[model samples]
Target chain A: MSTSPVTARLDRGVPRFGGFKLAIVRLEIRRQLRNRRTVFFTVAFPVFFFLIFGLNNAYASDPIGRGNESAFIMISMALYGTVLATSNGGATVSVERLSGWSRQLRITPLQPSAYIAIKMATSLVLGLVAILSVYIVAAFTHKPSMPLGLWFATGAAIWIGSLLFTAFGLFIGYLLPSENVMQLIGFALMLFSFGGGLFIPLSQFSHPLRVLATYTPLYGLNQLVHYPLVQGSFNWSWLSNLVSWLIIFTVGATWRFKRDTARV
Target chain B: MAERDVVPRTPPALELKGVRKDFGDVHAVRGIDLRIEPGEIVAFLGPNGAGKTTTIDMMLGLSVPSAGTVSVYGRTPLDAVRLGLVSAVMQSGGLLKDLTVAETVEYTAHLFTGARPVDEVMERAGISLIADRLVAKCSGGEQQRLRFAMALLPDPDLLLLDEPTQGMDVEGRRAFWKAIRHDAQAGRTIVFATHYLDEADAYADRVVLIREGEIVADGSAAEVKALASGRAVRATLFGADQATLRALPGVDHVEVHANSILLHCADSDAVARYLLTQTNAKDIEITARALEDAFVALTGSHARDESVQSNADEVLR
Candidate 1:
């Protein structure tokens, strides 16, 4: 057999993380965008919550901290959306793992780090969509009356701070069995939302329960995103809490990923 | 024969050196050493739980060996795959259910550097007709064909298929092997694992029979068949001396019943002739063993040898 045509088509160069990684990212984004259930949870659910809570008359004029109740409710809903979008994005790994696609990828040239990076990037994009969707709803219905700087800062803080949940989602995706994954995630999301003061402010709770709420993973993010709008300053405790949980979740995710991809 | 004679001087397409894999207390593969030259079509024939998938996983770099190493074209398996030197069609569940057949092929093609044209690959894999069907809706045979298309994307020089036709009907199996033969003619090395004796006999240039995590036989189909080639002679003889019957020419083993003697021999015709003329024997019958019997006999002996070896090791310890 002549070798010229076959040899010419062989790509001998080492694979780099450029176009190939982007291709995977694009593929994942397109596939996830088609899932209507995921779209509802990550994009629409939070917008609905924002609509219901932002239009309430109970907290509309009442002063909580720095911003009135409407602004506070809007920020809380936006944070809820951001966390859900990012975590749900990362949680898609469970489906891939269950289908044995991860093993298929192990045989390919794509590096594990590149795969994780693509998932995280996709999560960030979804988080951006969620935040914007909530903000758009707020703009049309009842826009929060806060300074422009504080508004941008709050949005930026919510987007960046919600990244910890992406790692958390990956950790759960690898840690739990696939069958119970979504149910557990939904239950945990509700618990975290309540405990982190997203639905109800921690101030109403007793001293001990309020203190416990501060230690939850979502608590730091909630406080950080609300700081500029609610307090107009950064809290060192909240920053430390965010940084520590970030490290913990990132470590947990990497460890679980390595173990999951190892030979069964 | 024509392909084997042109032995290229370059490194083999795949080489496994003393590879062993242990999962907790279960030893999946134990010390497998194999080499397949480029353009050679080799079949791994084994029964269930015979370590075929584990070995294939190591070869594809999806699983690391507990001992020894695997080299693909003088480089690591992962590197060889990265360079488009090798690709594989796994046993099951690699395709995403959400994507259509054509979309799956397109997405895989985008991952590689210079993938072949998606339309041509779909045609070659016989999935062009079902290009728009979602993977979840495709039948098992169609999904296998879609996997074949993905493996063809890189135009790889070496292809590994793990039970590529497991769920395929007879016609689909025939078409799949025909396509494989076409690729082999273009000088691509193919290694496939299957439990089907007919598939190995019909498709492989060399059949490697594995049993209990070890290679019991490796040769051309005919050559391996020769290992268990013999005939059985059963005859009813009155007043036959057991020693004299055992001493009969060409007889390898003898088992006596109440009214008959069964003989396993290299030349059943000779034994039959002796029994008819020299002894008061009646109702004599001779029959040759089938390839299935040969496969069983070959694998059965290996199982016995392994047990004996383990017993000896126990004694030594």
Candidate 2:
């Protein structure tokens, strides 16, 4: 009957991005982290890949078949983290869209930019975490790098590589059905990790596979990261290759999302 | 209805003009012209799949209308969203699955400049005790309340709800109705779709009935009921022939089902006397049609025929 309480509450006002959209992101992250299966597949899957590809062969004897093998394995490990994080971000977005959350948010005052920004931020943070988690184990226990510059370059390479993967992931998010998101992420991870010099270096493959690997985004990232970290040199060809894939994927993702949300 | 006395010439808080939506080949909402003035609660009444949701969706700008326009508070619904002048409680309850009740309300409290505080809205929504618990873990009733709280947070002039109490128990439903009435009395415009006729009767200042994507009836509860435009005298007859009952005076229609005969007539008193004199039936009951009977009569017999199986569960459970 009295208006004092409602009026008093109104006087204090809403927090900045603290309610709807921000809350949605926090809730999404918490839910994802709580799901042990998702956590393992996303956060811990890269670690598993690192163990199988980076440590077993490169850290063992027999020269790992070539001096460049460890560099290839590190690239594969970093690629594994970036791909997993970016794909998960897309999958999460698609699931929410199918589950009616997107429509619910559409009715609210939340802007489309805020919606896209949240997903991008979540993916970047997840990518950084995955990259750091894998690199820490690699640097100290095995394949130790002595120089600070290589570490910095490795971080930059991972960031650039992740940007491409995240863009590709966004494209996949709009293309795939919500029910098939997990399967798509898994399929892409395996395809790139094996043929793109993540598990086995390009030099170890046949002439055809080696040539095919150079055209893949994963291969471009491998070359970009490998040149600076292992050979201590930058390659313009590798940077161009990565940027070309990045441009293609970014354009595709932006176009797809705009079409999906348009009023007409 | 009493609140209608307060605001004299207020423009409609919500309006839908010739709105239409087609999902692929199926026409969902077809040419709906609706208007609700300030301080009025209008209940949208319809059976399932009658385009009630699609209509509400267009009104809230969740789905763009295929034809015509939807406006809220004299502006487009999309603009209303930007001004925080419209809020909604969707059928799914729209609560973030992982956040606790407190977090959901607290977060929504941040979306507007004049939103109610987290604690105050929680108490008002009667979810203060479950504030720290995750919304997904709450009971259906609690989740519904939490959604209403989220809608309330913005303190908007127009509130839209879809099946707002679909899953609540009787007591919870009663409490929810009380809150809704309180808000309506406070001069907020509301438009809600509900399956319960009593909800429309008890809380709504106006009721609109939609059937197969068309507006079949629209008016105040009694005014809409008046669309049936007839009265009936139901008599308890012993050893009477159904054939003779059909021939009674002032009777327009006669339906024979199981043990009783429904005599649809213009004058209840005339029919009662005629039934007593002709059929020798005692205990004749003469009564005006309730909203349900009026709704059935106006919408025709096909309205609740398919719902008979679920009617028991819908009424008692």
How much TM-score does chain B earn in each model?
0.74, 0.72
* True contacts recovered per prediction: 0.34, 0.27
Error of 2 at B275 (Å): 15
Candidate 2 per-residue lDDT over residues A71-145, each given as its tens digit: 446556766776777667756666666666677667667676667767777777677767777777666655543
Which pairs in model 2 have colliding backbones? A14-B110, A15-B110, A19-B107
Deviation from native of the Cα of residue B101 in model 2, angstroms: 3.5
> Residue-wise lDDT of candidate 2 within B1-317, one digit each (tens)?
56445543434688788988988899998899987777778999887788989888777776799999887766677767766678888888355676688877775665566666878777777888888898779988888888888888777788898988887887788877777776776778899997666677778889998877888889998866555456766766666676676666656667666556677766677778777776667667776655345465434533464467479778898
Clashing residue pairs in candidate 1 are: none
| lDDT score, candidate 1, position A169 | 89
Q: Assess each model's interface with DockQ, reporting 2 decimals per model.
A: 0.31, 0.23
Give the C-alpha lDDT of model 1: 0.82
User: In terms of lDDT, which candidate is strongest?
Assistant: 1
TM-scores of the models, in the given order? 0.83, 0.77
